[model samples]
Structures are given as structure tokens and as C-alpha cells.
Target chain A: MSDLTLTPNIDGADDYYAELLAMHDGLSREESDALNARLVLVLSNHIGNRTVLSQALAAAALKPIK
Target chain B: MNQIFETPMYAYSRHADQDATTPPRHKVIVVGAGPVGLAAAIDLAQQGIEVVVIDDNDRVSTGSRAICFAKRPLEILDRLGCSAPMIDKGVLWNTGKVFFDKRQVYDFNLQEEGGHAFPAFINLQQYYLEKFLVDRVRELQAEGAPIDIRGRNKVSAVGTHPNHVTIEIDTPEGSYNLEADWLIACDGANSPLRAMLGKDFVGRVFEDNFLIADVVMEADFPSERWFWFDPPFNKGQSALLHKQPDGVWRIDLQLGWDIDKDHEKKPENVIPRLKAMLGDDVEFELEWVSIYTFQCRRMEQFRHNRVIFAGDAAHQVSPFGARGANSGLQDTDNLCWKLKLVINGDAPESLLDSYNTERVWGADENIQNSSRSTDFITPKSGMSRVLRDAVLDLSEKFEFARPLVNSGRLSVPCTYDGSPLNSADALDGPDRSRPGSACPDAPLTEGFLLPKLAGKFTLLTIDADAPDVIEEDGITVTRLALSLKNDPTLALKNRYLGEATSGVYLIRPDQHVAARRPSFDDKLFRAAIRRATGKE
Candidate 1:
């Protein structure tokens, strides 16, 4: 019963995905993981709605039916 | 060698005081003839006060020490009649680019809106700055200004008194003693004057060293500040490149905390680093090489009885933001006007306390900003570095994260908010020119607004009627009226009288807004002048 926009929310989706990968290019394994964690925190702070965040977390954790 | 540093400009010369039977008393004695001390001496002399400047050394600073001069200090220098040569010889630029790991993250333009006289910033060698100031001092002296700069004369001991201060000087002949009604210490961070008085600064010492190399024969680089974070040339560190006058380029490389001081400063060792960064094809000669480790610190109080402290003698900050000499100039600019009023007896001695209050506030602002820039540049902890890198990474693609990059937030004018000198603010105008703020310069029909407000208390009115001059308790306040008809561009209205149809501003001698109102009020303006001069 959550009203969260989950379909095509980002423009230039491929570019953002490529940049997300490029961000960890020269960093070590631990540094890349730290960066990902920090990026998650930064984005979470940007999107401060707890209800939407909770829904996004649930959706990200769910698996596709095989 | 650069002739400015090599040739002694003010060599040791015996003054009449040295040969006198009784030690001659001076109105004001400024210790240290560096840029700050020279500026203090110049300001005090220009105000008809007899001032003497003493220094251990005889020449301007070497190695092109402080290169970046910000707008506010430039404005102050303009008032002192020394900005013409500085602007003529300085490399003016407002654009700065920040690069992260070989790719540019973002670029910024400090594009101050048009109509101001000076640019946002200029890069001129410190030697040139000091030399120009010395030249001005000479010009003032030629015009019979009561100013004397005694070189190779050092102050070894200082005795503070209730009404005056006794200074013991050291020269080749012998030690001599003199007294002064007031003493100003601009003797730099390692101020011997501060030590003689058992005073000290209390702040943080940053654990980082930056290698500065002033190289001649620079390549075709744009006249802009280019800063790099964790570039390949120096992995896990930062670098800065700036264009200076005379085809010289200043390059700073971050060498971590625990490095050999002497070994790293060698030309043989430094050239390798430079070659690595410059790709070995470029031809450049190292004009000067220096390693500097900075601290963000300041004294508990600038005023100590009859002796006062200004510039590095009072406070210091890391060199990241070019705040050292810049803020030192501002310190004198804030102090000299108040000191002049106090010395002239137009205002009470309590007026000098406003100098301590306002400049201490200014020093704290510089220290805080430079400290933050130091932290951002050299992250202490692993998590901090991670967070810094994350911000830089995000800044590459995200416009919102660009503001997070702090490669030295350049120095700006400090607004003395909540100052005791400030009267109530009632003008419905822009906050940038509010009470206790530096007056933002705008173009007048003739020349500029700042030149008109030079070295006096002014009542500025825009479309508002006010008297030509007002005298309150022996202090004089003159009027500078401007109308909307003359301001065709509306720069004045936009900067000072925003939204309001008319405005009146009471400006301090140091070009700071003392108070503002919607329209002219006789009693209010008179009372504000009294308060500004510390009569209240």
C-alpha cells in the first residue's frame, strides 16, 4: 500500500549506471565498497522520506520468481 | 635572483633618535616592516599621525611568498593609493577549475557582478606587493608625511606602561631605548614582540607540508586557478597550479606530514617531481622553492595595554586560502581608522576596543575557513578520506555535489555582524550590504563608490534626502547622495537598495556599513555616528 514511483524515475538511466561503475574504477576493493556505502548514505539523505525509503529497500531486497 | 629581494631597499641607517641624549618618543611604533607592518605604518602616517616602522631585515620578502590577493584586500589597497601598480602587474582571474583524479569535476566562476572597480582576485608576487607599498610609503614621505622606516633596527625588549610603551632596540652600534604612545606588532607568526610580552596564540597546528615551486617559463595554461585532488602525479594527495606575473607559474604539491624538510626542498629532488608532473618535455627553471607547514592559530586578545597586535603577530591561518597577508591587510584597515579617531581625541579610547572586537571576529572567520579548507584538502582519518573521495566522485556527474568541493574557499570580506558599533538595521535592502557589513562597491557616474568613501565616515543616500554633513560630539559625518537618475544600470539600487525605493546607509571609516534606514532620520543618524565612534 505504498505510493512510490518505481518505473523509469531517472532520465539518462544508462549514463547514471555507467557513472556509478566509473566512480569505483581506480579505488581499491575496500575503497570501492566504502564509496558505495557513502553514496547510499548520500542518496538516502537526499531522499529523506522514510516511507519511500522503506518501500525502495523492500523492493531492492525482493527476488524475481524463477 | 630577483632584484626586489636581493637588493636591500631600506638598509641600516642611523636615525636622530639613535644619536640623541634622551630617547625620542614617537607617536606610534610599528614593529616589523613586512607587508602588514608597512601597511599599518602607511595608514597611520596618512592619517597625520607620526609613525615609525622598525624591522630586523631590510628588504621585501623573498621567494614570491604570498601570491594570491583577494578582492577585499585589493579594495583596501585601492584606498591606500597602492592598488594601481598591483592591479597593473597582477594576473587577474575569476575562474577556477577543480579536477579529481585526472578528470575535471567542476569549474567555478567568482564572477562578481559588473560595476565593481577591482576583480574578484589577483595573483601577484608578495615582493611586488611589498615593494609597491614601500613605494607608496616613499611617495607619502616625499610629500612630507610624518613616517619613518628604520631598517636593521630590531625591538629586543618591550616595557608596557599605562599611557605609553617603552621599546628597547638593537642595532649594529648598540642597543637604544625609545618610548611610544602606542605600539603595533606586525612582526609575523613568530612575532618576537609577542614573545617579549609573554603573549601567545591558541589554536590548532595542522600536520601537513606543502611544497611551493615558483617556476619560470610556464606553458600555455589559462590564467585560472587549477586544483587537482588525488591526481596521478602525486597519488593520494592534491596539487595546485596558478599563473603569476612575469611568465612565472606557482605549483604546490602536498607532501604528507612526516617528510624530510631539508631533503625534499632540494632542487635536485624537487625537479624530479616537477618533471613527473610536467612530462619532461617542458622547459622551466625553478626561480624559488620552499616548503611550508602551516597552523591555524590566533592570540587570546589582540590588544595588550598600550601595545597592540595586527596581522600574523595577532593571528595566523593555513596558507590554503591565501588568507595570511590578505587578512593581515584587513586587520590594519579595520584598526587604523579606529586608532586615528582615538589618537585625534575625536572619540574615546574605548573606540579602540572595537578594533579588537571586530578584527578578532575577522581573524576567527579566516582561521575557521582556512581550517576547513585544510581538513578538506588533507583528510585526517580513513573515513574522512573516503567521504571526501565520495563527494569528489559524486561531483563528477552530479551538479548538486559540486558545491561540496572545498579546495580552499577563497577569502572574502568579513562582516562584523552583531557588532557593538552597529546600530539597528531598518533598511529594506539586500543582506549583503546590511549593518556591520563591508560596503559592496558599485559604479557611480564619475568613478566608483569605494573611492568616494575612502578614509572617512559617510552617510550614503540613494534617492533619499539627507544633510550634507552632520557633526556629533566632535566626530564628523559627511553626506554622499546618489539618485536613481544617475544610476542608469541600477547596480547601486540592486546592491544597496534592493526592493526599497529609497535607502540611507551610515558607513564607517573602514567602509563598513554602520547602520541603514529606509529614509533619513536626523536623530537616528546622529546617534548612529556617536555609536560608531564609540561615544555611546
Candidate 2:
């Protein structure tokens, strides 16, 4: 399954992503997978950037589940 | 028995010199070293889980943003072994005075009803609160608690993966990356993380801006909260005076619907307004003055993937009631414990989803209440203002109008009613049986407090009829003959458990009742715990 990425073009984008990553760390493998499954669904629902969401999904796939 | 050698405290110490470079990676990373973030970090660390806290600021801000501390936060701090210092430093206020055109209309004492461990509210500066938390973090670390605090290092980027989260940071030295198992965003209203998640923060932004001025004054104002409904200072403006420790006072002045934003910072502009509110005869220098805008909004969801939002990032409430920071701290309290359980494998992954469900619902309620209060205080249209004025005028004379006048609303703790963690059967019974309510505080003999019996799953049975209900797990079962008498003014007593008999209540670590049953059953108790931890 693919993951999702969220990239904000506004100011403080890095800080925002850092917080998201921190939150992701708290999730379980199953929960993380479920989140990854819904990554496109959830990000597409809020942000209109398809490219960013695709990149985020690729990033999610790169990191193997612990 | 052989005598054991008493090891000195120093012998147990983990020396800082032993390679600070390869610090153990934590399960969770909490951003913002404020009260809420620190509380979450400490709670998880106390549970024998690793936590790392990062903040960009080197030192805590001395500004008195949130001066009021509620009882629930006090309880949470107590769990972290840090409440004593806070209780010792804060000024407890149980009475408040409401004024109309500089005339005292009604005086209410929060202590008139007293089932709570703390007074309805405690006034302490945010800086002191942060300091107490920092000190505790250090103390816990020294005791071998798994908590790492990195100050002056701002989070630069977050890359969330299926397994872990890589958090890039910009330190004074250079940029670095640290991977954490999970991340909790406890950052304030301008949460940088929330924006990246693509969550929409939707709500009304009040047009009226306020001037918050903190000053040291030698005046005759009593040690009571004073709120002027409609004062002549700014004309059609509201002013509030809250007494702080060591003769300092925090004054909030509503600067009308529109004013030059730039002029608010000028001492000349601010001093005149302060003089008008405090009377020209009162001598006080303007220590700090800044304009503030109130917004009643909430994030669509508190969680997305591995990232969860807490405090101001999740929601924004008007300062009319001191609900902003208090609610944020409560959010942290709720999320941290559940995260601990899931990370520790004591509960299933589904338990983490409850954080989103419960907190989002609570955020909605807080937003509604704060929005209503804001509408009442500052009516948008002329017709709304006129209606509010009429209600205020009637409230003075008509005894029936007192309820509307007093605004029964205060920033008390909120209960979660419809959470998935609550039992479906308990939903239809009395309010006491419902999950997501704050546990009722009751007096116990031996100077012991009852709410202290909470913080973990508690099976509180009012009678010996359920003697065998006690389990040796994380739950503590309190068997009592009858419900203890509680003070009327406390919301927990009046709102949740109104003289209930022989019922079982499950309290979450955040002190909110996760579930309740008419009788103690092992199945229900297990289900309640499972639901609270999101394992269900």
C-alpha cells in the first residue's frame, strides 16, 4: 500500500511537517498502515496538492514497518 | 534478614558525562516546552516510556498569558510529582466580583460549594508553571526517567513514515535529524504542524481586539476577579482585572470593533486606556501591552496518520473564559496516557483513534461555549447588542433573570459523552453511568482525597454488594457504602453523579470517567478499560 505526504507552500512549512512526523511516531504498525492507506484520502480531502501527497506516499513506503 | 547496604543517591545517578551523544530515541516527541507539552512528556516518561521534548525558545516567556489554572490540570501535575510547587506558588481565588458601570452587581464565591481538591481556580503566571514543569523534567531525568529535553532547537521538518517519524531540527550549532516512534504537537495556536497536515481550522474570528496589559499596581483593588460588563474606559468596551502574585494585576481591555493596530503598542495610547479603566488616581505603570484577537475555531480532526494535535493547535477559544490553555493541557492529558498504553502494547492500535474522536468532540463543545460567551459579551450587530443590553438591564432587577445574568458557563472541565470508549448500555442510564465525564470529587477520611484514586482505570463501587469486582490489573476498585457528600458549586458533583448508589465508574488517567456501570461486572470493567485505551 502507498502512503501520503503533505507539503504546505506557506511560511513555517518545515515546522509544520516536523510536527506531523512527531505525531506519526506515536502510532502502532497497524494504525500507521491504516493511516498510510487513508493518506491520499485524508490529504486529498484537505489539501489540493496531488504531487505532495504522492511524495508523502512514497516516503511512507520507503520506511519499513518496525 | 541480612541488613542491606543503603546506596547513596549519588551512586544511583546517571552521570551526564557518559556520552550525551547517543541519547536513546524516545517513543514520542513532544514539541513546545510549555505546561501542556511538558505535562504530556512527564506523564509518558513516568510510565517507563521514553520521551523527547524540543523547543525553539531557550527560556520561558515571562508574559502572563494564562494566569488561571483549573483543578484538573493541578491533578495531572500532581501525577508528575510537580503539583506541590505549583499549589504553593499560585493564588487560589474562590470568589469573583462582577461590575456594571463600575458598580458591583453580584459577588459569587466559588468555594461556597467545596467538594474539589482545589478551589474553582488558581491564579499563577504561565512562566512559573513552565518553570515548575522544567524543574520536574530535570528531576525525573536525574532519577533515570526516560525524558530528554532539548531547548533552543526548533523543529525544522517532519517526515512521517509507516513505521517512524524523522524530525529535522535547527539548533544553534546546525541542523540535525532525530527519529521518533510517534509525535504529539502541543504547540500553540499558530501550530506549524497542523497547517502541513492540511487540516482546515474553521470558525468565527471576532472583530473586536483586546489590549492585555500586565502591571504592578499599588491600588485598593481587592484580591478578587473583577469584570466590567460595559465600561466607559474605551466606551462600549469590557475590562477585566485579575490579581496576580506579588501585587501584580493583569488587565484586559476590549478596544472596540476597530482601532489602529499599530497604535496599541505605543505606551502613550495604552496608558490613557489603563488610566480610564483603573481611574486616574490609581498609580500603575504599563509593564507590557499588546493587542489580542479572539478566534473560536477547531481543527476538523485532532489526528491524521501518526501525528496528533493538542492544545491550541487543535482548537482556539475566546479568552472571555480562561479556556484556551486549560483545554489544551486537558487535551495533552487525554492523549498522552492513551499513547503510553498503545506504545507499551497494553492496548491495541485502535485505541489511538479515540484521541481524535474524544478530543475533536470536546473541541467542538469548547468552541460552541466560548463562541456563545463571545456573542453574549460582544454582539456583532446593533440588534444583538441591544438585546444583550436589555438582558443585562433586566438581570439587575428581576430575580428570575439571575441565571441569564450569571452566565452559568465557566471554564470547568468538559465530559466526553458519546465517545466510542463509553459503554453502549451505560449511555441510556443516568448521567453518572456515562463515560467521558469528569470523576466526581468526594471527601474521604484520613485526609485522603477521592479524585486521587482516579488517574488510572478505577472501579468505584458505592457498596460491598460488588466486593469481588476488584481486579489486580491497572484498575483500582474503591468500595464505599454510599456516595460521599459533595459541594454544590462543583460541576462534577452537580452535573455528573447526583447522589448515585451502587454503581461502577471507570476513570481515565486524565481524570475523566471513561465508563460506568450500574453493577460491577468483570466483562464491563475490561470493556471499559479496553474502550478507554482504544483497544476495543
Candidate 1 has a TM-score of: 0.91
Clashing pairs in 1: none
lDDT of 1 by residue, B179-277 (tens): 999999999999998988898788998888999999986567688889999999999899998899998999999999989989999999999999887
DockQ of each: 0.06, 0.01
Across all models, the iRMS values in order are 12.6, 25.8
True contacts kept of 2: 0.00
Candidate 1 on A1-66: residue-level lDDT in tens? 444454345564434533554576667768878787898899889878888778656544442211
TM-score of each model, in listed order:
0.91, 0.79
Model 2 per-residue lDDT at B84: 90
Q: CAPRI band of model 2?
A: incorrect
lDDT of 2 at B364: 78
Window of ten residues with lowest summed lDDT in model 1 chain B: B394-403
Segments of candidate 2 deviating more than 4 angstroms: A1-66, B1-25, B102-104, B406-408, B425-433, B465-501
User: Residue B226 in model 2: shift from native, Å?
Assistant: 1.9
